[model samples]
Structures are given as C-alpha cells and as structure tokens.
Target: MPTLYHAPFSRSTSILALIEELGVADRIDLREVGVARPDGSGGADARNPHPEGKVPYLTHGADHVRERGAIIAYLTDMFPEAGLGRPVGHPQRGAFLSWLFYYQGVMEPVLVLDRAGLEHPILQATFRDRDAVFARLSEALEAGPYLLGAEYSAVDLLLSSPFQWLPDAMPRQPKLQAWIARCAARPALVAVTERERAGLVA
Candidate 1:
C-alpha cells in the first residue's frame, strides 16, 4: 500500500483530500510526522525516505514521491479514472501539465519568498515576481469556476491550497474568492479535513 508521510494541516492535507476525491482513502496508509528542519540540510524524520525529510512526501511501493505538486500529478495519473488529470491525448493536457509544474516551479517559490519577505536573484530571474504569479493565477481563474474550465480537477485542490492556509493572503478579488469557495466547499476537501482532525486528536 502507498504510505503518506503526513503532517496535520500541511500540504499532506491536500493529498488526503485528493485520495478522498479518488475514492482510495482506505487503500493508503497515513503516517503523521513533524516539521522538517528550517534549512533543507536534513530530514525532519530520519526514517523518512525523502532526501529532505518532509512531512508531505510519500512512499508508494518503491517509488518515493516528494513535493506536493509531483505527488498530485503521480496520484492523478495512477488513478486516471477519477478524471482529475488531463492525460497526453486529452485536448487540455498541455495546460494540465503546465499548471502542475507552475505550482511548484513558480508559485511555491514566489509565495514562500513573498510571505517571508526574502528574495534571491535566481528566484527573481526565474519567476519574475509574485505579482506575475498572481497575475497568471488571476487570469486563469477568471475563466473559472475551476482551473481547467468546469471539470474541478486536482489543480483546484493543489492551487487553491495556499489561500486556505493563510486566508488573509487571498486577494480582494471576487473572482478569486469565489473559486476558493468552490474548492473549500468540495465534499472531498470537507471530508479530509474532518478525518485528519480526528486522526490528529486520536
């Protein structure tokens, strides 16, 4: 069975929601873990196979998937019947892959830097600025109520996540807030929140 190295209320919660969306919650194992070292020099849990020992990594059989974006892509592909992914043959497949990569490649770094008030030349060179990232997201969301039109794909759960974690971070845009509302109202998300909260208390 796939084992998820989880931390309550972190990115792993997004995966938990995805598992619920895929209807495979019972097929997987979830292990609670603590925070990784602030610097990426070591793992939070030495037993965690992920090089950095992160709470949101996973081990699926022999495949060790790190990073929430990659995990989302892997899970959606592994359970294609859920229709959360846009496979190669699909018309929107290019857009699908772009969004996943964008979340990690650009959004993640920019958001972190923006939140911490830190900056680096490399990050600036690669992602431009947080405004660019938000602009792109705002443009995509303008086509909402979902990232890829009306399908309500895993992209919704993955991308809408930051807003959930820091509610005030969401811009004052009505369109963005509406999209986030759709994501929060998702039955899968609601279910996972309850389950994870109960698991944490236990």
Candidate 2:
C-alpha cells in the first residue's frame, strides 16, 4: 500500500482531493504531518522524505514521490483503474501533461512571487511577466468547464488549488470563476475539503 504523508490546510488537500476524485482514496494510507508554527518550530514528519520539508509526500514500496504535480502524476499512473489520466499514446496525453506541468512550472511560481512581493529582473523571470501568466490562464479558462475543453482530469485538480486560493490575486476572469465553481461542486472534492477542514481545526 502507498503511504501519503500530508499536512492539513496545505497543498496536501489538493492531493487528497485528487485521490478521492480518482476513486483511489481507499487504496492509500493517509498520514498527517504537522506543520511548523509561525516561529518555525515543528518536529520532523513527512518533511523527512524531502529536502524541501514540504508535506504531501507519498511512499509506495521502494518508490517515494514528492511535490504536488509529481504526486498526482505518480498516483494516476500507479493506479490505472482510477482512469484519472490520459493513457499513453492518446492524443490528449500530451496536452494533459502540458497543463499538469504548467501548473507547477508556471502558475505556482507566479503566485508565490506575487504573494511574496518579490520582483525579478525584466529579462529573468521564467513566465516573463506575472501579469501575462495570469492573463493567459484567465483566457484559457474563459472558454468554460475545464482546462481541457469539457473533460475534467487530474490536471483540473492541480490547476484548481491555486485558483481557489488566490481568487482576487488574478484578474476578474469570468470563465475561470465558472470553472472554479464547477471544480468545487465535485462531491469528492467537497468531502475532502470538509475532512481537511476538520483536521486543520483539530
């Protein structure tokens, strides 16, 4: 069985939702890791699995996976019965992976930079400009429903987390707002959010 090392009210919530959405929630063991306080003091838990000291780590047999995007990809591949990912050689596979990686590679960093109030030299930022990244995402989502047209996949789970957290941080993109509502309406996501909320309060 795979063991999921997670922290409440953090990125782990997204992974938990993915597991539920994929119908593999029962197959994995969920382990909660406590986060450090504002003073930066906390005992080692899942952080021991990664140098970054982040939660949402997964260990299955001899394989260990960390990071939100990597975790989703690993789980979707490991449990093919869930059908949460596009199969290899499928035309949508490339586009699926593109959006999956885009969330981590582009969106995440842009949000982090915005929240941290950090500035990058004009020519250095990978996304080029933060506003441009937001604009593109807003427009892409404006088409409505999901990131990939009408279908919702693990990529939506990956993309929804950041959007759900920082709604006002981005421009008022109507399509993106509608997409967020659609994602939030999933029963599995609602259950996971409720459970995670209870865990955080406890």
TM-score of each: 0.88, 0.86
Query: What are the clashing pairs of model 1?
Result: none
Listed per candidate, the RMSD to the true structure in angstroms reads 2.9, 2.7
Once fitted onto the true fold, the runs of candidate 1 whose alpha carbons sit more than 4 angstroms away are 37-43, 119-122, 200-202
Q: Per-residue lDDT of 86-161 in model 2, one digit per residue for the tens?
A: 7677677787788878888887877777777878785335655566776666766656467776777888888877
- Specify the poorest-scoring 10-residue window by lDDT in model 1: 35-44
* Candidate 2 segments exceeding 4 Å error: 37-43, 46-48, 122-124, 142-144, 200-202
Per-residue accuracy of model 1 over 1-202 as CA lDDT, tens digit each: 8888777777778988888899987777877777654454334676566676566887887888888878888888888999998766889888988898899888877888888888888879987787787777789876767889877998888888998878857867787788888899999888878876687411
- How far residue 154's Cα lies from its native spot in candidate 2, in Å, is 1.0
Worst 10 residues of 2 by lDDT: 122-131
